[model samples]
Target chain A: MLNIKDLKVSIEGKSILKGINLEVKPGEVHAIMGPNGSGKSTLSSVIAGREEYEVEDGSINFNNEDLLSLDPEERAHRGIFLSFQYPIEIPGVSVTNFIKTAINESRKAQGLDAMPASKMLKKMREKMRLLEMDQNFLSRSLNEGFSGGEKKRNEIFQMAMLEPKLAILDETDSGLDIDALRIVANGVNKLRTPENATIVITHYQRLLDYIVPDFVHVLYNGKIVKSGGKDLALELEDKGYDWVKKEADNLV
Target chain B: MEDLKEKLLSSFIAFESTLNGQAKSPIHKVRTKAIEVFEEKGFPTKRNEEWKYTNLKPILKHDYKLLSHPESEIEFKDVKRYFLHDTDTYKIVFVDGVFSSWMSRTTHDGYDICTFASAIEKYTHIVNKYFNKAASQEDSLTALNTAFAREGAFINVPDNTIVEKPIEVVFFSTNSDTEMMTMPRNLVVVGKNSQAQIIERHQSLHGNNVLTNVVTEIFAEESSHVSYYKVQNDEYTASLIDNTYVDQKEKSNCTVDTFSLGGKFTRNNLNFNLTGEHCECHLDGITIIEDDQLVDHHTRIDHKVPNCQSNELYKGIYDDKAKGVFNGMVMVHPDAQKTNAFQQNNNILLTDTASIDTKPQLEIYADDVKCSHGCTVGQLDDDALFYMRSRGIAEKEAKAMLMYAFSNDALKNVRIASLRSKLNLVFAKKLGVDLDFGL
Candidate 1:
């Protein structure tokens, strides 16, 4: 459902994603493992149409549409979702209100009417149950004073509600505890379908244990140097990123 | 002496002279003083200290035909539209500058609701005591308002009597093309241990280059509770200068909220004096200006006695070359020990050309007081906006979402639902932003 060819991106004229080439068909779970500043997050933001990253040379095709040509909101309406590394704290906007607006906007883009209030509430309650989120969480302001674990779980809740075709989890496991990681993984696992795809970007191999990836890619120095089955995640976890960098140097 | 010289000054030397003929014996003393102040410091030029940010060159170019009485009759339907919904309160309507006894309700047997003219004749001492006490001739706008003071409503709640409904005073300026000026003098006295809520609404119809100068004084006695809500919504060509003052006695509670959604070159001076022990006051204002509109708010809160508390918060959102200014001051007197005063002014500039000048000042003479003031002027939070946009909300909706959230802190303080909803609608429409969760 997603194709990225030689994605060369830069921010402020500094090279970030040097040459990223990746492909993920429907129902595939791909995991990208890299150390900090290895361009893992930059790749996710680029595919989700964050304006900060300037595409020096490359093309991204999502569902036969030019992903790079769309605005961030337009990308979202076209079934592309990005779970931010750091959730934003929007004060005075209730979680329910925010989620409802998001859902309605996406639906309207697809020429569909907004979900009725009763159905929307029911759907939200069901998603909250799937994520094990407290009912009071819906009434509070979005991410304001929320715990790290709660924020991650809320992101998963929103992901479930939107049901995007391609979901990009950008460091979703960065701040999660063991229980939160399990809840987040379980929620993602439940929403999987043969027509959808997910790209899990993380440094640790522990998250791969819950949502097992069909493929794993190691990113180093702004390039994907190695690609393999899910076992590569375990190898990287055991050897660390330094081993990968040394091997790439030896190969070059 | 300035005071003596003011008495000798003509109350009607300017373009409009009929005001001097209508000034009663009780109000003449102050009227003369106001004229002297106006002459000494004519309309403020750009060089004046207080009028530095705001330019009044447009008003000086025109000659205003002074209006002292109601020129045309206003129907009850029009007055009803200005009344607060779901409240059975007395309605006093003022057209041009004269009170409409025919349109006002006279069944208020429990409350002392009378016009300024009738009150001046019946309660001469009360009218003489409070009438120009709130606004002084030191201010050019205040002087201009006083030099042509005319008929307005006087509301006095008896001692220990709690008014269940809110008293509304509606001021309408209708159909005058030439430069016109109308001064509305309102005095609200909440007796010792009484409680009441008052709403003052100013609306204009069918005129360009018209001016409305209003002065409102609220005397809140010991342990009395009063909430004053002012809505300044009028024609884009109309200019308004409103001076509101509140004097809180021992243990009294007072709140004044000014919502400036629509106007052209509007300036508001709001002052809260916590004069007695353990008094509390809250002052909040929100102004949404766009399309070359200019709005200014100068607010001061004085803590005089020990254990008094005051909180002042004002926010402005401007777009499309609109200019906004907010100057807030919190003064804690030497004797006002343990005073807790907080002041905050926040502004959001939507367009690059839109501007806001905000200054929050806190003067603490008492060492034991806790006082802090802060001001922030910036665009919407980029991270918050991006987050909303990433969720499929359009750029405009995302901006509106954050803007409304920014204003929610001030709006939540309003306890009245009807007033809150109306204010929310006005804000949304003025900002050109729609609210998904409509009130």
Candidate 2:
């Protein structure tokens, strides 16, 4: 369902992702594990088409269409979703209104009419209940004065609402407590389907205990150094990044 | 044309003599001082600091004839009809700047209301104490109004009497004869522990080039509450200069809101004095100008006593080649410690040619006071615009929606429901935004 070939990206003339190649099929959960500054976020941003990163060389193909040729919102309309590391707070706009606008815009891009308010409200309530959010969260301003865990949960709630084909979670567990992590993992696990794919990017294997990735890749120095089954995440967690660095250096 | 200024000056002199001829006491003294000030200052030109951005060249170039008391009486049918609940409440009407006794109503009990001309003779003591006390001839135009103050409205509320009904005064400028200038003065007094609301509306009927210079002074006594609303919807060729001065006593509350949507050149002066501790004052304004109109609002709130609170917010939306000016000042006296004062002026320039000059001033001499003043002039946020556009709303509708949202905070602060609805209608007609969008 997704193919990336030697994707080299740079921001402000500094190359962040160098010659990285990855592939994933439907019904598969791919976990990218690396230490800080390992180009883990660069890969996700490059796929999501954030304008800040300059694609030095490479091509990204999603279902046989050039992903890099589209705008941010265009990619968003094409079912490319990236859960932000830090969600921006939009004041004076309620979360329900924001989500409705997004859904309508995406649907319009596909030549659909605006969704009815009644059905949208019902769907929103069901999703909010799934994430254990209060009724006030739906009416309050979008992400304004929201706690860190609440913002993450709201992101997952948005993901459920949009139901994108490919989902990328970047550093979603960084600021979350253990309870928040479990709840977020449960949300991600519940949304998995055979027709969609998930890419979980993290630094530790703690999240792997719940989401259980099918493929685990260790990324270091702007390139994916090794790819293995789910046991690779546990081995890296026990031996630390230096052992992996030595092993990759020997392989090179 | 050469003798027009001389003719206006003599007309004002004749008016002064007639006013003093009727009652020659404290009011005569005040009017004489105002005339002297007018003679000294004359009319302000573009050289003045306050009048620099707003030029009166058009007014000065025209040969405006003085409008005397007309022989044809002003009829009640000329005024806009309002099905108010209180039928016994009085009404004072001004036609071509002259007070008309036949066009007004009266309550049997003098405690309720009466006309200014009739009440002047009966309640001279009450009128003498507050007449011209708050707003005087500080400027040339103000002095000119004072010189021609032949007729005005004087309202007095008895101590501890709650005036449940609103006193409505209609000031109509008739230009059926020729280009005219009308000046109407008003004094409203709220007695101790009394409550009242007043609506003074200014309109021009059958007037092509009419000018209305109105001065209203409000005295809110201790523990009293006063709410005043000024609605200016005149002809395109009409101009207005309305000034309101409010004085708040201990524990009293005063709110003054001015809605300026229709006028060629509109200038308003609002001054509030918090003379007693624990008194609160609020000044809110919204001005929407189009087609090269010039709207200027100058407000000053003086915190004269300790522990007083004052809030002022004035917002303007200027489109086409229109220009807007807001000069607001919050002054804290030296002895007024622990005073809380806030002032903000924000403007949205829809077109590149549209201009705004907003100045929010804070003069603090007192220690241990909380005072803040800020002014912002900019176009809409680009990110916000993109966000709204991405929602499938067209660019024009999204712009209008954002502009309406920008003004929502200011209009929602209006406490009166009827007034809020009226103002919303005016805004909706201009911006094409439905009034029930967010409510």
Candidate 3:
């Protein structure tokens, strides 16, 4: 459902992603595991069309459409969702209102009528229930004074509500306890379908045990150096990234 | 330079003759003294520190005819939109500085909500004691208003009487073809243990050059509670200089909210004096201006006695070369121990040409006092904008939503329900959005 060929990205004249290639098909879950500063988050941001990163030479095609030419909101309307690691706090905007605006804007972009308020509220309640959130949580300001676990769960709740075609969970497992991890992973697993795809970006292999990715790729120094099945994550966790670094260094 | 002042001095005789018995009363003596003060100070120039950011030389240059009578007739159906129609209120309406008895609904049941001219004769003792007592006589504009103050609202809530209906003091200037000026003075006294709410507005019917210099003095007696709301939404040709002074006695609570939505130039000098122990005062203002508009808010709160608290919040949004100024001062006297005062002034400049100057001053002489002040001047948060945009909201809608959220903090404290809803609609219209969210 997503394709990236020779992706070269830089920020402020400093190169971050250099000549990377990745492809994901429908009905498959991909996990990109790497150490710190490995451009895992940058890749997710580039795919979601963040403006800060300058893509010097790259081509990102989502559903056979040129994604780089679209704005962030346009890409979002095309079912591209990026769950941020540090959710921003928007004071005075209730979560329900914000989500409704987002949903209506996306629908308008596609020349569709806005969803009925009753249906939206019902769907929001159903999604919040799946994430084990209180009904009052929807009335509070978006992510303002929310706990880390609550923020992560709220991200998953948004993903469920939007039903994005390609969901990139960038470091979603960070700052989450075991119980939150289980709940988030369970929520993601429940939403998986044959036509949708998921890319789980993480530094550790703990999140993969619950979500259980079909493919695991080790990203070192901006490029994916090795690709294998779910066992590769366990291998990286047990033996550490030193072997991957040495192997990448030898290949260079 | 002396043309407007000389004209005002020459017109005083005609203005004085209008007051039947009040010409020889003690209030006239105060007026005579006030005119002398105005003659001495003249119009404040830019050299004055307080008037540095604001230049009144242009507004004072106009050859404005002081309006003493209604020049044109206005049907109540034509101007009824200005009033809060949904709420029950005691309305004191004025047209061209003259009271419109047909348009006003005064009260005589237990409390006095009538015109200043009648109140001066009917409740002579109350009018003589509280009139012009709390306002500053040193300022030239205030002194100017006092010299010309004749017809306005006078509200008196007796001791221990809770006023059920809020009072609406509306001044409508219908000088369609001529440049005119009006001064409206209001005196409100809430007796001990009484409570009252008031809404004041200045509206011009046509886009003519109309200047309104208003002065309102509110005295909250011991343990009384008062809330006053000022809505200044006039045409581009209208300018207003509002001087409001409030005095709170022991255990009293008072709040004044100033909303400057539309005006060519507006200056508000709001002062609150906490005279006794355990008193609370709140001053809140929200200003939204665009296209060469200017709104300046200068507030001072004096914690004169112990165990008093004061809070001030002012927010401004300037767009397209508009200018805004906020100067807030809080003073805790030597014996005013355990005083808690907080002041915050925040502004957002939507364009490169828009500007805001904010200064928050705190002078604490007491040993034990909690006084904190915060001020910020900047554009909207880029990260917050991006966060909203990435959630599928368009860029313009996202920016408007963020601006609405930024101003919501000040709008939440609006005490009157109908006025609050009206303000919400005003804000939505300013932001160019159809906001249906519950406030």
Maximum-lDDT candidate? 3
- Taking the tens digit of each residue's C-alpha lDDT, what string does model 2 give over A31-99? 999989999988987787666789988889998899889766677787877887777666655787667
Error of 2 at B42 (Å): 2.0
Q: How much RMSD separates candidate 1 from the native structure?
A: 3.2
Once superposed on the true structure, which residue ranges of model 3 sit more than 4 Å away at CA?
B437-439
Off by over 4 Å in 1: B1-26, B73-80, B106-108, B435-439
Over B1-439, each residue of candidate 2 has an lDDT whose tens digit, in order, gives 7444466678766666566456476666776788778777877787998877888768655556675566345555545443133244457776766665676664636464655666567777877887777775487777777666646777788779887666768777667667777777787898889987777887777757877777888999999998887776667888888877888899999988877788899988888988989999888888888898889998989999899999898888999999998999889999899999988888999899999988888999998999988989989766555444433334564566666656756665565566666666667778776443342
Residue-level lDDT tens digits of model 1 in A29-58? 999998889999899988877788899998
* DockQ measured for candidate 1: 0.74
Candidate 2 residue pairs that clash: none
Worst 10 residues of 2 chain A by lDDT: A84-93
Model 1 chain B: ten consecutive residues of lowest lDDT? B1-10
Compare candidates 1 and 3 on lDDT and give the better one: 3
| Clash-forming residue pairs, model 1 | none
Tens-digit per-residue lDDT, A1-252, candidate 3: 799999999999999998889999998999999999999989998988789999999899999999999999999999988999999999988999899999999999999998999999999999988999899999999999999999999999999999998899999999999999999999999999999999999999999999999999988898899999999999999999999999999999
